[model samples]
Target: MAPAPRAQPSPVAVAADVSSAPVSTGCGNGGPTTHRGLAAATAASRTMYWPLLRNAECRHGLPAGLLDALVFQESRYRPLVVSRAGAGGLAQLMPRTAGDLGVINRFDAVANLDGGARYLRSMLDRYRSVPLALAAYNAGRGAVDRWGGLPLNRETPDYVRKVLTFFNEDA
Candidate 1:
């Protein structure tokens, strides 16, 4: 009788394989990003910023349209605004989320908008679709991820539609 030897992979090879795999950048849909794509995304943007979205946009590499849509949906550029749900500032970020995003004062227009934009960029990267990203932003990423799409939350759909339909004047 004869037996064959089984070979095991080396640690270096394994490490190489792991390192060579694609990594999520946590910006713009977890897909490849570029200033050009970002430029296109924000191409239709017409928002005025106290600190200017251009800086944040350049920092996180987000499409301007999506950012503008989110801002319009959340607070319509009112950094001092707060939702009944406790979302606040121009981006309508919750206190905890805002804090995690490095926003010391959510009511501050610059801080809020920057934190919100960063969060939205992450959502876009995670979901890879504008509607899904908007849904995650409105209903929480857990809900969108759990439902395998937009959550069943009543307001999520409306939020998504409103953000996506920013092109329509009446929207």
Candidate 2:
């Protein structure tokens, strides 16, 4: 006799009302409690365009998870995100760097990611250390070389640690 076919599991159902709760107005009457849901939705949308992790991994030998971590640290995966220093896109490529990397459209998801990854790879090869490479990526290669290694700045140190931690966690 032939074995019986296995039944497919049914999809889980979520409560619609759960996402439509009342928000705290801080006055008296509550507003809409969709802040968490909205934030999550926004984040998911941002991740869709996070090309550094996806495109770089596909074309430039960069790790997707590392790219994701970098994007998280740089812009929290926000494609429209621009730094105070004028860096833009998911990977936060500076205008000059983006131009040098041949990123014609810095806002284009794929272009930005590829450019950032290539730049990162070049820095890594030059530094021969992930920490130093990341420091260079953040602070600049001249600064890294000037210090004879990674700088002793609190922000750079924390940034390196955070990226490494994210990398390790994802790995």
Tens digits of per-residue lDDT for model 1, 1-171: 554332233221122221232232333332221222334323333234623554565466665445655776787666678899999877898988987888999987777767877887788778676666777888888877666666655687767666666623321
Worst 10 residues of 2 by lDDT: 10-19
Q: Which parts of model 2 have CA positions greater than 4 angstroms off?
A: 1-43, 50-52
Best by lDDT: 2
Q: What is the TM-score of each candidate against the true structure?
A: 0.67, 0.71
The whole-model C-alpha lDDT of candidate 2 against the native structure comes to: 0.63
Each prediction's whole-model lDDT (CA) = 0.62, 0.63
Per residue, candidate 2 scores C-alpha lDDT tens digits across 1-171 of 865333222111111111132211222222112222236855675546643355564455454355655766787667778899999987899999998999988778888878888888787567655666677889888767666665665577678777766655644
- Cα RMSD of predicted structure 2: 19.2
Clashes of each: 7, 2
